[model samples]
Target: MMVRTVLLAGCVSFFWTGPVQAGMPSVSLDLTDIAQLRLQSISFFLMVLLLSALILKLCWNLLAKDFPKLPRISYKGALGVSVLWGLMFLFVLTMISGARELLTPGAWEKSGRTYRLVEDKQPDDASLAAETTLDERRRKLGELRSALFMHVATHQGKFPGKADETTFAKEFWLQPGPLQARYGYVAGDKQADPSEPLAFEQAIYGDDQQLILFTDGAIKVLPTTKAQDVLNGK
Candidate 1:
């Protein structure tokens, strides 16, 4: 009856811990991390083996005292039993680890000294399209800035006072997509402060950020309110 009880307890413990251990996803590790993990596992196994041996020995002593007719188990036999228990524990751990890797799709990453799930950071189709459109707008603004500088060089250091696309060469003015609105140009000459706002998008882009150009020929993506404040000379 006592032997049956011990076996039942062991089975219960295994089932209770198995799923918890198996749920941990496998992680990618370098040589150093692998070595450390192995060392820790060995240490844990040895500790469990020692504790199992001590418990078995204590049980044997109690049984021998309480019931002398009971068959005696030697120290070597107890140690052998502990070894078997330890091996079973390690086997369960190995099975759980293998099951985790089989069930999960991605490898976890090592962050500092710990492991974390690797997240999918690839942008979705809409995000990609938005980014591509933003890039096109930036390129157009760059061309417009170059044209403005060229106009200043030829027209006595003065920018076009009018915001019309015809104020410069026809090819220089490109309409932005989705909104099809022309860039809002501010009247500024070459002699104005280099940091002064010269041009901006007529519409706000994604995340309330707008593309703005300065008299210094610098372009930036800024918040709509802040860009407005700069344009207002605030």
Candidate 2:
């Protein structure tokens, strides 16, 4: 009964340590302090040993029921097996963590004393606003593409001419906004090549990227220079 109680206590301690460590304040390790580092290493090793012992105890209990003639594991024998398992587990975990840090350096950022994952980093307001604006522009362009197609279907396969902005606006319920003002339309019919650029945004974005709508009703974002070449019929 005492041995069972000890095993239960070890299991509880092993599982509880993770959350407790996670909740503790982040401490910057002093590379010069060998004694402190050694203490931390020893604590980690002992925790792993206890966890391995608990796992072995559970496995022995399960197997003993099936193998009735099997001799029970002595404390010393269990300790030896636990140490081997613990060492292997620690080595594998260290390798994986080291590989991740080396291969994807940008995935982690040091903030104050702690390393934070890129996913956990919050976007600043300016970045958030820019992303929102870009999304809105894309959505507006999509709606405009649908409206142009509707116009083509009704007007004998021709899109609205550049001279008929008022007619196009009223027919498509398009409001005067950044999207409508910044984007230029090409006068073309449905018979034009499907990959031909039908409309494109001016190079107004800070990133020098433009959104283009094709005759086939596809929208794509391209670098401003390439988009300009396409617009100029090159």
lDDT of 1 by residue, 1-234 (tens): 999999999999887844554566778656687799888989997787777787898899788888979777876788898888777998998797667767884666668865577888987544543554678888989998988888778878777776663356765564455444577877644454656788887653456778888888888988888888888888
Best by lDDT: 1
- lDDT score for residue 178 of model 1: 43
Residue 65 of model 1, lDDT score? 89
Highest TM-score: which candidate? 1
* Tens digits of lDDT, candidate 2, 101-172: 999988987786567787765766445434546677788788778777877778787776662642456434
Q: Which residue pairs in candidate 1 have backbone atoms (N, alpha carbon, C) closer than 3 angstroms, thus clashing?
A: none
- Evaluate all candidate structures by whole-model CA lDDT and list the values in order: 0.75, 0.72
Where model 2 places Cα greater than 4 Å from the true spot, the runs are 1-132, 163-166, 170-180, 188-192
Model 1 — TM-score against the truth? 0.41
Q: Model 2 — which ten-residue stretch has the worst lDDT?
A: 171-180
TM-score, candidate 2, is: 0.39
Clash pairs (backbone) in predicted model 2: none
